[model samples]
Target: DQQVKQNSPSLSVQEGRISILNCDYTNSMFDYFLWYKKYPAEGPTFLISISSIKDKNEDGRFTVFLNKSAKHLSLHIVPSQPGDSAVYFCAASAPHTGNQFYFGTGTSLTVIP
Candidate 1:
């Protein structure tokens, strides 16, 4: 069974709009959550993260939200631009189990100009 999952395979949005990507996890032990954005032929880059202690974390145009009780999380991209188009992945890690990260499949975002 997959610990982390991204239900949406892809999303399309216009430039200057908001793009929302969702993720869910089955493991309750996960304490740290991170969002990564990846481009073709390159590795996924860290975007934002929220610990179980915090409900939300933001960095520039990206924001991550966590709901521990519901075992859910989501990423928000404000004023989405064409350059923001990429594959977004969600990852989770448990402190007690070392730094092993469980990652969601990924959500592809297409920002139309």
Candidate 2:
């Protein structure tokens, strides 16, 4: 079973529009959720995170919403820019795992100019 899944392997959006990426998880034990943005040949950088206790968290142009009841999460970027074109990975970990995370394969977002 895939504990974490990003159904869409890629997404396309025009610059200045909103971009939304979705993810799903099967494990309820995952208490900490994170979104990471990765550029080519580089490691993922942490974007936003939310604990199981919270439903939504936002940082600047990025926002993450967690729906615990449905075991789903999404990352939203408003006014998407060409610079935002990259792979986004959703990751989760339990506090007991020492922050070791399980990652989704990834979603490549292409922002058109």
TM-score of each model, paired residue for residue = 0.97, 0.95
Across 1-113, the per-residue lDDT of candidate 2 in tens digits comes to 57899999999999999999999999888999999999999989989999999999999999999999999999999989999999999999986768578899999999999
- Backbone collisions counted per model: 0, 0
Q: Give the lDDT of residue 2 in candidate 2.
A: 71
In candidate 2, which residue pairs clash? none
Position 11, candidate 1: lDDT? 100
Top-scoring candidate (TM-score): 1
Candidate 1: list runs displaced more than 4 Å: none
Instruction: Count clashing residue pairs in model 2.
Output: 0
Model 1 TM-score is: 0.97
